[model samples]
Target: MTIRTARDAVTAAALYLKWLGFRDIMQSPERPASGIDLRAPGLVAQVDPTTCPATLRDVECLWLNGLSASAVSVFFSLAGYADDARAGADALGVPLFVMDLTGTPQPVNRPADELVSTGAGA
Candidate 1:
């Protein structure tokens, strides 16, 4: 649940992507830098299981990597985030996903007003 390993994060991220309508998803949670945790078509998602606070640099690197591949950027962190990381995500209009003890991912920072018609539609 706390997602202690990259493998665990990979499973969680993959499930999250599936719920987003991605039938085929790739995961590489342990890999660093441009290494992505989940990907499908035009979406690129990454997961951070680090115990320390996720930072702005982490978001920036993920954002840059996703852009290089012309994919939408998504971030998931089990360890929460630094203020700059959260702020940067909001400014960049990215979804900042956080996992609970059950390893379920939710977009904690993506505003409800920005919500499109996600069939889950919550």
Candidate 2:
């Protein structure tokens, strides 16, 4: 569950978003100044999966998200960046979502039969 790189963090965020019904989630090109990760075009989510420490300014992005279009921030818990990320999100007035990589599994069941079942009356 230790995310080694930003890419790993982003991938995790993408999966979580997909689970939340955000399809075709795409990430932005890695840039020095973008300060963002995944971007779902129509969705008001500006993902910033950072392994480094966050600052007060970083938190502002969360608030910005709300002001702009109800964007949400997703952070992957790295070495010690959780506090900074949280603070940044709080300051920015955005809801921060953290994945529990070490927590117990809470399985979500999906009906396998539905994948292939075309029922007129089965």
Candidate 3:
């Protein structure tokens, strides 16, 4: 299914997480007060459904949230990410993925590649 809306993005993200072997996945409200889109055992995820690409602040926020929860963090963006955001994600070891319209998220960085190879255990 084409991900045309935020709700579609959330649904796709949740499904993708499931495919990645993440169990007990929990989705946040359409507009989550915490800005986190999803969560699972040992994981925290942020999905950017906006037209604007995710920025460095976005990446950092995801990292911070995950750190506070003592879980690994991942990011998904429909519009992709800014250069600085990518750099920050790389430095922070936060996995980054580009959420294509097909509802499949493609890895955008090395950490993300590792995540794909290792599944949820990473």
Candidate 4:
């Protein structure tokens, strides 16, 4: 049961959200340099597999918008990228959710407090 990349995770997330009554709001604009991958009504989500510095800023914007809109903010990533996602979410005062798309859809929602660790100290 090898886990795949974050894009795969996000695609799985989109399918799950659809199953849970969410429609496909928007897709990436196919820009090679764009940071945002998808944009849904009331929610902004991203899939990250690397510690790319750009992801932090991108997630921050998503977090702020998601918070303002009272949306269920999410970041789907491979296990390795969880820390980076959490850090970005914390700085933006938003929640970072984790979804194990590799198996049975085990999703974990980490609030700001829980993700604020001394090492990462948000």
Give the clashing residue pairs of candidate 3, or none: none
On lDDT, the leading prediction is: 3
Q: Which parts of model 1 are misplaced by more than 4 Å?
A: 1-4, 111-122
Indicate the worst ten consecutive residues by lDDT in candidate 1: 112-121
Which pairs clash inside model 2? 59-88, 63-92
TM-scores for all candidates? 0.82, 0.54, 0.96, 0.53
Per-candidate total of colliding backbone pairs: 0, 2, 0, 0
Each candidate's lDDT (Cα)?
0.72, 0.45, 0.91, 0.52
Put down candidate 4 lDDT per residue, 1-122, tens digits, no spaces: 23365555556656644554556556565523434455666556665545443256656766765677676555554443345655766665554544554623444434533432311222
Model 1 Cα displacement at 40 (Å)?
1.4
Q: What is the C-alpha lDDT profile of model 3 across 32-83, one tens digit per residue?
A: 7667989999999988999899999999988999999999899999999999
TM-score of 3: 0.96
CA shift of 62, model 2, Å: 4.6
lDDT of 1 by residue, 17-78 (tens): 67666666776535855757777777777788777878998888878877888877778888
RMSD of 3: 0.9
Lowest summed lDDT across 10 adjacent residues in model 2 is found at 103-112
Write down the worst ten-residue block by lDDT for model 4.
113-122
Q: Which ten residues in a row have the lowest lDDT in candidate 3?
A: 26-35
